[model samples]
Target: MNHTLTFNWMMGFVIAAMALGAGQAQAAYVIPMIGGAQLGPMDGTPMKHLDISFDGTNLSVHVDDMVPTPLLRPLESPDEFDPAEPWAVLTDKAYNYQYGWNPAGFITLPSNSAIWVQRLSQDSGLESYQRPPASPPYASIFASDGDIWQWSGSMTHNVYAVLNPTQSVYSASYRVYLGDSVTGVALDGYGSDDVTLLFNATVSAVPEPGTAMMLTLAGAAMLRRRRTA
Candidate 1:
C-alpha cells in the first residue's frame, strides 16, 4: 500500500473510534423521578401540588434525553426506532394515602402524541393496591389519553413512560396536577407548572463493526498463525 493511502485509512479509523466513544457518552438519557403530593398551609383553601423533580439543574427535559432503542430490523427500517422508556417514576414511602393524576382533568398530554405508561413493578402497599391492578413486572396501565393512573407514596411503584417510535423525533409536554381520588377534582388551584420531555434520536450509538473489518482481522490472524507454524 502507498504511504498516502495508509495515512488516509488510519485517519478514518481514528474518526470511527471517536464516533464510537461519543455515542457511548451521549447515550440517550433516562430520567428518574421522585414525586409526591406537597400540601399547602391550612390557613387558606385546600391546595396540593405533585412535585416532580430530578437532579438536573435545569429541569427541562431536553430533546437529547429520550431513551434510544433502535428498531429490531434496522436494515429494513432504518429511520424507524422502537418504543422505549426514557423516564421512570418511583416513590420511597414518602406519603401514606393513595393519590393519582387525572388525565381527563388536570393532567394533559401532548396532542396527537403516541405515549403510554406501564407499571414495571411495585413493592407491597397500594393502601395497599388502590384498585385491583393487572399483575406486574410490566403491567400496561394507561394507553389512552383519558386513562387515569393512581399510586400511593406509601408503596414503591416503578412507572415507566413508553414512547412509540416514528420517523421524526418525539416530544411531549405534561401538565400535572394533584387529583382527589374521591370527587376527582384538582387539589392545587394554581395549575401554572408543567414538565416537557423532548427526545432526539441523532446519536446512532449502538456499535457493530463492518463486515470488511472483521474479515481483515481474521486474515491477519491466519497469516500470523501460518508464519508461526
Candidate 2:
C-alpha cells in the first residue's frame, strides 16, 4: 500500500484498538489472537471479518480467529463448568454464529482462524455511538461465557482474548448504531451494526496458582511412590 493508504490503514486499526482496552481492567486470563485485515479480498472469498463502513452517506458495521497460546492462568474455568465464576475472560477464536452470519466485504485470513472485529475508529463518519456493558473501566467484567463487550474510542488499549480449557464457543457482541451524540438518541435505521466476536475454547476446573502447584506436586509424589513400591 502507498504511504497515504498505509497511514490511513494503520490509523484505522489503531483507532479501533484504542476503544478495546479503554478503561478496561488490566487483568483477565489472556489467550493471544492473530489475524490480518485488508481493504480487499484473499483466496477468492471475501474474508469474513469485522467490516466497518460508511460511503459518505451512511455508516454500517460487520463483525466477526486464533492460535494456541499458553494459558495465562491455565486454571481459568468458564461459567459452563465452574459456576463459582473463575477468571472472566475475553477470547479470540471463530464466529460460529450460534446466532447467524454477517457476510463481510473486505478481509481474509492467510492461514489460521482469528477473531476479526470492527475497527473501533472514531471516524465512523457517524454523529455518535454507544453500546451495552455500559461505559469502559468496568471492574471484573469480561467472561469466558458469551457476552458482547463494546470497544469505545475513549482511549487506546491493547486487549487480548483469553481461552478456555474445553474450547467451546463464546462471543463478544457489541451493538453499533448511529446517534446524535456520544450518549445520544439512535438515528440509524440499521440496528445492531456490530457483533461481539466469538472465540474457541473448552471447559475444565482451574485452581488458584498456589493450589494448582501443590496439587501437581502431590500427584507427582503419589506417582513416584507407586513406581518405587
Candidate 3:
C-alpha cells in the first residue's frame, strides 16, 4: 500500500481504539467533608451538616468525629445490655430509633438503591438500652429520608453515644453501598455539637484490559507516523 493509504489506515485505527477505550472506562470521583461543625447538648437532637456526591458507581466516606444514637426500648435491666451485642427494635417503627445524622449527619442516597454500610474503623462508646434485636446487622436502620443512620458490628453497641464530659474524639471509616439505580446523595450534620467531623472519598476510573491494550496500540500508531514523516 502507498504511504498515504497506510498512514490514513493507521490514523483511523488509532481513533477507533481511543473511542473504544473511552467507552470501556468507568468514571469515578470522591467527595470529602473536613472539620465539620459540632452537634448537641444531649437534648436528643441531631446536628452537623454535610453534602455528598453520589453518581451511581461505588463510593466510600471517611468520618472523623460526632456519635450515632441507637434507639431501642428502655430495658428493665440496663446492665443486661451488652455493648458488643446491642439490640435493635424489630418492628417497622424501629426506624425511628435509628439515628443516621449523629456522627456523620444526614446523608441522602440515590433513590431506590439498596444501601450497604461496611465499617472500616471506629472509636466510640456504646450506650445500650434493652430492646429487641432487629434483623441481623440492622440493615433496616436506614430508610430513605426518615432514617439514614448506620451501625457497625465492630462498634461497641446499638447506641454510639458520647459519655465523657471532656469532649472525647471519635473517628471511623465506612464503605457506603448503593445499588445501580441510585445516584446523587446528600448528607448533613444537624443535631451534633462540640465536635468537628471530617469526610474524604477516593474515586477511580477503571478501564477494561481491552481498553488498555487499545490505548497502547494507539500510542504505537502515533509513534510510527512520526518516524515515517
Highest TM-score: give the candidate number: 2
TM-score of each: 0.27, 0.31, 0.26
Winner of 1 and 3 under TM-score: 1
43-76 per-residue lDDT for model 2 (tens digits): 2213234445444344466443322221212222
> lDDT of all predictions, in order shown?
0.32, 0.34, 0.34
Which ten residues in a row are the worst by lDDT in model 3?
30-39
How many clashes would you count in candidate 3? 22
Judge candidate 3 at residue 202 and give its lDDT: 20
Candidate 2 root-mean-square deviation in Å:
21.3
What lDDT is obtained when candidate 3 is compared to the true structure? 0.34
- Please, what are the lDDT tens digits per residue for candidate 3 over residues 48-94? 32223334343433332263432222222112323334232221111
Which residues of candidate 3, in runs, are more than 4 Å off? 1-45, 49-52, 58-113, 124-158, 162-167, 179-229
lDDT (10s digit) by residue, model 1, range 89-146: 2222122111222222222322222122223222222212222233443444444334
Which candidate order results from sorting by lDDT in descending order? 3, 2, 1
- For all candidates, the clash counts are 2, 25, 22
